[model samples]
Target: MDRAQEGGINDVGIGALFGLVDYRFEILAIMEHARHLEEDYGCGPHTVSFPRIEPAEGTPFSQRENIPHPVSDKDFMKIIAIIRIAMPYTGIIISTRERPELRDQLVRYGVSQISAASETNPGGYDEEGDNTKAKPYEKTGSTGAQFTLGDHRSLDEVISMMIDGGYIPSFCTGCYRKGRVGADFMDLAKPGLIKEYCKPNAMFTFREYLEDYASPETKEKGLRLLKELTQTFPKEELKRRVEGNLCKIGEGERDLYF
Candidate 1:
């Protein structure tokens, strides 16, 4: 981290693998680490992820019996809520390491970043699954996979779930592109102003995804989500900009953002 910052890589993420140590100790260490970075660089972590250990194909240690420090579901939720309160500005990531139900529950709670439809093993994406519609995807016994994923839903499936819950499934990368980093990012984030840029960007990206990739049902639900979001947007001028962007997107514009 020190070398990255000194070498001009200002934005970085910090996290602890939950099963590596006691969850209580790991959470504290994560907080302290964030504090350390903030004191030295005037910016804390860009994101914090707490992926619990999952079983891996050849690793005996990954088995429940061999695991050293396992975190229970209840405790994991507490960790998420605590991190949200402690450093509310930082991104909170929930990966596919968690079960689908838990991952769904998490996004509504405190998680701000998530991964879906991921293939961890080398060339894992190329393999065919036996049941594509399984509620929780089964690992296809792919060798070389570092760990098994608990959530096996496709990207569209994941996004559809989020939309069903009235959550905006965002694919925006505008802030980094706009050079919102370090102190600049913090200034907006701490004041909650970043939402003005982020929500609209999310709408833009969601719209783009619906137009290009979403299933017909997903597109309908996603469009409804867009309407709710636009109607509820707090700022008027920015809402107009968002409206314009959405219009342009309908006319084939791509990669628009705040």
Candidate 2:
């Protein structure tokens, strides 16, 4: 943490790879690490990734064969919930290491960020320019990745899934852009008032994605979901502003936020 700060890095993510030791002890140690960062450097982790061990290509036979403490789906859910309760403001990032069903459940259990469409190998993002196409959704046995992933869905698919689950896929960075960090961000999040800004930001961003990036099928469903979610916002004034902002985005404007 200190080294990151010294290097002028404002945001740093901290995590302990699960399955090495007792998860209970690890969670407490993670909390203590966060506390230490705050106490000393005035900033704790910006995000945390809870990844379990998975076999990767080229791993030594002996290392790959050795069994470690395994984390079950149920226990993983408990860890996410505990972390959410322990650190209300820190962004919890769940990777694609968990299966789709498990990832879905974790989202509802306090996972805020997820790598729904991740490719571990180089050039995986390029389809035409590079020979390395998007790797198949599977464990990292065929390629060189630190760990294998479970979820293999694309970004569009993930967005559609989020809508189906009644969640607006967000691309907003308002809080961070506005310099909210450390204790300040936590204070707002702890009281549950961050949603006042986050909800509208999500709607606007989703509107933008639907207008520009979404496929015809995804756009149709996404817009319908957006309309439905709009009606659910309690404050008429805020809702009106969100509608206006979404309208602006549709007019080719961008980067609107609360």
Candidate 3:
């Protein structure tokens, strides 16, 4: 983290593989790490990820057969809940390694960031028909990936689900862009006033995505959902600002924020 900051990186994310050891011990260790960073650098982990072990295709059949310390669904939730309450201001990220149902449940357990779409292989995103594959790393021999992914939805599909789940799918990076970091970031997040800026910024970015990137069907649904969501914000002043900014966005104004 210190090296990254010295190299001009402003944010850092950290995590522990939960199933490798006693999860309770790992959580306390993570907390200690966060405190150490803050004491030394005036900033702590910007995000924390929790990933559990899973079976992969390229692993040895014998080792795969004898899995170690697999985390149960109930224990998973309890761990995340404890982390959430322990670090309310930190962004808790859940990856696509878990099934969709489990991912959905993690959102309610204080997960603020999620990997909706990801490709692990090299050149996975390109249109070229490259079929090159890499073997998973093993201490003794080549295997394959350490784990398999569970969620396979596209980004648009995930956004639609988020909307259905009453979450505003925000693409806002306003906090980091605006220099809110370390203690400053926590102040806004803890008091819940950050939403005053983030909500409107999210609407703008969602609008931009709908205009430029979304498929026709997705655009239609996103716009309709955006309209419905706007009505739920009862604060007149905030609503007015959001309305003005949204109109500007529609008029091709970019990066406008509260």
Candidate 4:
């Protein structure tokens, strides 16, 4: 981490697999680590990922009963929520190791990022296609994955579900692009001014995806959500800017952001 900082890459993310050790201990460690970074470099973890262990091929430790300390569904949810409340500005991410229903709930609880349509193995993406789609429900077999995934939905499928859940499928990379990193990101985020950038940036990226990649049904739903969200901004000026960006995205502009 220090090496990366020395090399001028200040942004970093950190995590611990929950089932390897007790979740409580892991959470405390995560908090202290973030605090340490902030004290040392004026920046902490940009994101914190909490992936519960899942069964994997050729690994006894990956099995449910064999895991050193297994985290229950209820406990896992609490952990996510705790992390959210403790570090409100840092992005909390949940991976496909979690079940679909749980992932949905995590979004509501505090997960800001979700990894979908993942190909975990080295050649899995190039050779095997999406293991989530190919082996949606399989848990223990060798399907060319590091571990059996719990959420096996495709990107479009996941987007549809997010829309149903009243959450925009965010692909926003505005903060990094806008040079909001390390201490700089915390400045706006701590006081809530980040919303002025986050929401509009999310819409811009969502618009690009809806225009170029979404299925007809998804596009319809996403556009409607976009329209509704556009009206939600407290500032009319920002809302109008969002409205214009949406138009340009529809008119073939790409990579537009705040």
lDDT score at residue 150, model 4, on the 0-100 scale:
89
Ranking of candidates on lDDT, top first: 1, 4, 2, 3
lDDT of 4: 0.85
lDDT of 2 by residue, 1-258 (tens): 778777877778999888888899999999999988888877678788898877666665314346367777789999999998888778899888789988888899999998767767654667543433656547543555666678888788888888889888998888888876556776676678888888888888889899988989999999998888888878898788878887888899999987
- How high is each candidate's TM-score? 0.92, 0.86, 0.82, 0.92
* Tens digits of lDDT, candidate 3, 30-50: 898888877877677889899
TM-score attained by model 1 = 0.92
Predictions in order: lDDT: 0.86, 0.81, 0.77, 0.85
Report how far off residue 62 is in candidate 2 (Å): 9.1
For model 4, where is the 10-residue window of minimal lDDT?
A: 128-137
lDDT, residue 187, model 2: 63
Clashing pairs in 4: none
Give the best candidate by lDDT.
1
Residue 207 in candidate 4, Cα distance off native in Å: 0.8
Q: Which residue pairs clash in candidate 2? A: none
